[model samples]
Target: MKILVTGANGFIGSNFCKFLVSQQIFPRVFIRKNCDMSLFKQLVPEWKQLEYVYGDLRDKSSIRPAVRGVEYIFHIAGTIKGSSWIEFYEGNCLGTLNLIKICEEENPDIKRLVFTSSMVAGGPGTPESPQCEDTPSKPLENDWYGISKYYTECCSKKQTNKLPIVIIRPPMVIGPGDKISFDLFNIAKIGIKVFVSGTPRQFSMVHVEDLVKGIFLCGTHPKAIGETFNFAYDGTISYRDLHEVIATKLFHRKYGNLIPIPIPPPLFYFVGLILELVSKISHEPPFLNRPKAIQASASGQTMSNQKAKQILGWKPKFSKISALEHAGRWYQQQKWL
Candidate 1:
């Protein structure tokens, strides 16, 4: 099958590319002109048939050729961090809209467009109830990334009749090439864990391996067309539980137990302010900014993969703990630890 994969160098997309190659499907990967080739080269498996189309999604001229002859399109390119709402809207919302418009003009009969969306778009969840596909989306206030993604999802759904599209929302994805997980795992390696002072927040997570499988199902499964599915480990776990899992279950090192450091929301914002200031000088957004600080202090964010399991008959092969172990090994192998 002719397939086109966007964001092929990113954490989840890189894993999807590898999965495609393993299945003997060589997809044409769409990359930006200024994308980091080093990380892309290291993460994406090489194959003689593997091809690349260098272009930016916002530029219609560049994206047309990438979608012209492809049977399936994996629209995974998006910005998780942005300096403002417009920046997020341009990359996450407008970019998808542009691709949709171009695809309608170029390849009207395309098989499917599988979009990798974030559970953040569906808003934070509580441990009492994990977020489901049917959940009414309520993205955090001032969270540009989440708001933009939510709008994108809404826009994509509107074009369902013209383009076969499937939306897959992933919660706290963990695997190789993930920067946030590296930070979390790396800090855990030092026998310390951070927690905000409040009710322990819950989380839903998926290994990149299983997330790619869900994405594949969304692309090819008949029932997945014109639908949105959240792919994650079955249920939610508290951050406390997650912290223990990483340090005890994965590390199994001396240090006895990880020292828990509880910080207030105000302190998190203080740190975020400092990082934001640093970002001004560096021109690179810090992982923890004001909006991120809001997210960090927010309630548990969880999701349910039941729809994918039932409709696509897809079952996750890795639990959160097992996934962390796998990610840990990969980090060591990549010398990213």
Candidate 2:
């Protein structure tokens, strides 16, 4: 089967490529010219089978050739952070719209186009109630990243009749090769654990391996077409619990001595505002901006994976503790910790 995976060099995309190659399926990978190939290079023999197509999601002309003769399209590329709303829209919204247009106009042989959206698009659910597939999205206007994804989903729906579209909205994805979680682990290693203030915020997360499995299932399963699913573990975890898990795995029982500090909601917003101001001059988006801080401080951004389980016959293979340990071990092995 000839498949095309955009953002093939990214964390989730690279993992998905590894999974496909392991199944004896060498996918045609679409990536930007400057994307790091070190991860794919490490695959050695298997990497040779991958067909590389250099392209940018924002460029329709570049995307055209990448979609040609492909049976499956995994649209996994999008900007997570940007200096402005325009950057987010261009990368996430326009990029997605361009791909859908190409597939609709040119790729008659395309069997499935799996779009990797995010839980941010669906709006965060509370601890008592997790968001499901049917939950209506309520993204804030200022939340450019989330709004961009929401727009991408909208674009996907426009081509549902012409293309078999499957949208996978995954919550906080954690596992090997994940840098965000690695940052958390590093913070814990320093003996200071930070928590957001207000009502305790909880999150739903899935290991990258399990998430890619769900993506594959969405691509292959008949019932998944024209459907949207949230991929996450069965339960949710508080921020404090997440830190404790990482600290325990990194330092074992000695994590009990780590100091826990809570940042008030207003302070988070203030810091975000300051970062946003600095970004205007630097022209580079800071890791933590005002909108992100607001999101971090918000309570209960969890989701249910019941739809994925029932529709695609999928469930996470790793528990939270086991998954964190797996990620920590990978980081240590790579000397990233």
Candidate 3:
């Protein structure tokens, strides 16, 4: 079956394309004008079977050609930068709208559209709580990234009717080639000690490969259509255990001096402002952006993925340490650390 994958060069998209190719299926990729395809080249060497199209999700005319005659469209492309939320709306909300329009006009015969949504929309500190597929997302979610994803879901539900559409809400997706998790790895490698909030907060995570498997099944699984599936591990990890895992791997020994001091959110913002000013002058990003870190840490985040396993028969294979080890090795190979 022919399929179209947007952002095929991104971390998750590239991984999913590679998975499909390994299964002997060729999937066409739609990319934007300025996106670098070098990531695709290094990761997926069997490019002859992979079709490439240049289009912008913000432009209706540009998206039409890519949607033609495809059986499935995995809409995995979206913005995730914590700073500057306007870009998120344009890329995530408006971009999805354009693709949905194209699907209606060009590929009305498409089998399904599988959208990758974020778990942040469910709110922070959600572990130890039973979150079902039909739970209404708390409207008080503060993060801009989550807000953009929530709106994307709204737009998709409104405009989509030609084909069955399934939403995959994944938690802290972990695997190789992830820059966000690389931050934690880097700190461990350098033997730097830091403080973590001393609370028994659970964090949900999924291997990239497992997430890919879920996405592939979502396209064809009849039971998955029009359903929202949480694609996370069945279990959760605490902040203390998470830090210990990284420290042990990086330091070759157990180490902990974590100060659990809950600084006021406003004080955190004050520090962020100074860091932002310095970053602007130095032409470099701050270690932690004020708004993003405050939101992520302050609001505990976790979820359950029972629906994905039950509906799609998807099982994740990587543990937290295994994921960290794979990411560390990749960083060493790429000299990214």
Candidate 4:
């Protein structure tokens, strides 16, 4: 059972690859040339268990060898942030289409091609009313990342007949070895928590471990073929409650007083604009960009886990707070905190 994991150096992808190694299956990992492997290396000590294949998803020649003869292709690589809409499109949509064509032409007999879609792809929902797989995608115009992923899903679905494709849309994924949440932990260490909105923001999320297990099921399950499911946990968490959880549950010790500061939208966006200016020059996405700020200030952004639970018989082992506790401990274990 040959398997190829694209974006294997990423948080979820790397963790899934590690899980595969535990099952005594050394999956082939497709990585970018000269990409950072520090996190992936740190997670997997017996790194030799993975067959590393360096290439770009956009490069056909580079990916042909990686796509050839693999039974399962975990298409987890996609742009999370970018300087512009085109950058997101190239990274998410074009690259995915490229992989799909290569799979069709080079290895049509592949058992499954599992895509990691974002929950935002089918959004315009709140915590009180979450989006399910049956709901139509209503990606916001300001969010290029979400739109790109939706476009990729649209493109991939067209080729489902040609290639076995299973799309799993994951909510805000939080867990061990996540590089994105480093800033939150760092801020927590400084004994401060800030928010732009007075009303707490509720969100749906899943631990990486649970999400990876779901992805595995998607790759192997016959029912999941040509289907889409949301791989989110069965509940929601707010930023304020999350801070409390981090302080009390993350350390499991007497943590320092975390000062909660609430600022107006104007002030927050002012700071975000400054960061965006700096990011423009750095070619890195600003942490508090327009779309991100919208998400931060919104009331709720949630996805339903009913489809995953009913179809895959999958439920998250760790609750929202417990998941954060586990992730925070790992960050400390690796000195990321």
Best-matching candidate per TM-score: 1
In the range 1-337, model 4's lDDT, one tens digit per residue, is 7999999888888799888877878889999989878778877777876788898988988989998878999999988866579988999999999999988889989999999998878865577788889888888767777889999999999998888899999887877777666666666666677677677778888899999999999998879999999987777877666666687776553543678877676677577667668877886445566556656665568888898988888877888878888888888888877
Superposition TM-score, candidate 4 onto the true structure: 0.93
What TM-score would each prediction reach against the true structure?
0.94, 0.93, 0.88, 0.93
Better of 1 and 2 by lDDT: 1
* TM-score for candidate 2, residues paired by index: 0.93
Assess the local accuracy of residue 74 in candidate 1 as a C-alpha lDDT between 0 and 100.
95
Instruction: Look at candidate 3 and give me any clashing residue pairs.
Output: 124-300, 125-300, 125-301
Superior candidate under lDDT, 3 versus 4: 4
Residue 253 alpha-carbon offset, candidate 1, angstroms: 4.1
> How many clashes in each candidate?
0, 0, 3, 0
Q: Which ten residues in a row are the worst by lDDT in model 3?
A: 256-265
If both were scored by TM-score, which would come out higher, candidate 3 or candidate 4? 4
lDDT of 3 by residue, 57-161 (tens): 898898888999889999999876535678778878889888887788888778899999887665564655745567787533456667888888877776555
Alpha-carbon deviation at 76 in model 1, angstroms: 0.6
lDDT of each: 0.83, 0.83, 0.74, 0.82
- Candidate 1 per-residue lDDT, tens place, 13-34, comes to 7888889988889999898988
Sort the candidates on TM-score, descending order: 1, 2, 4, 3
Model 2, 52-94: lDDT tens digits are 8898877889988999999999989888876578988998999
Model 2 segments more than 4 A misplaced: 43-45, 254-256, 270-287
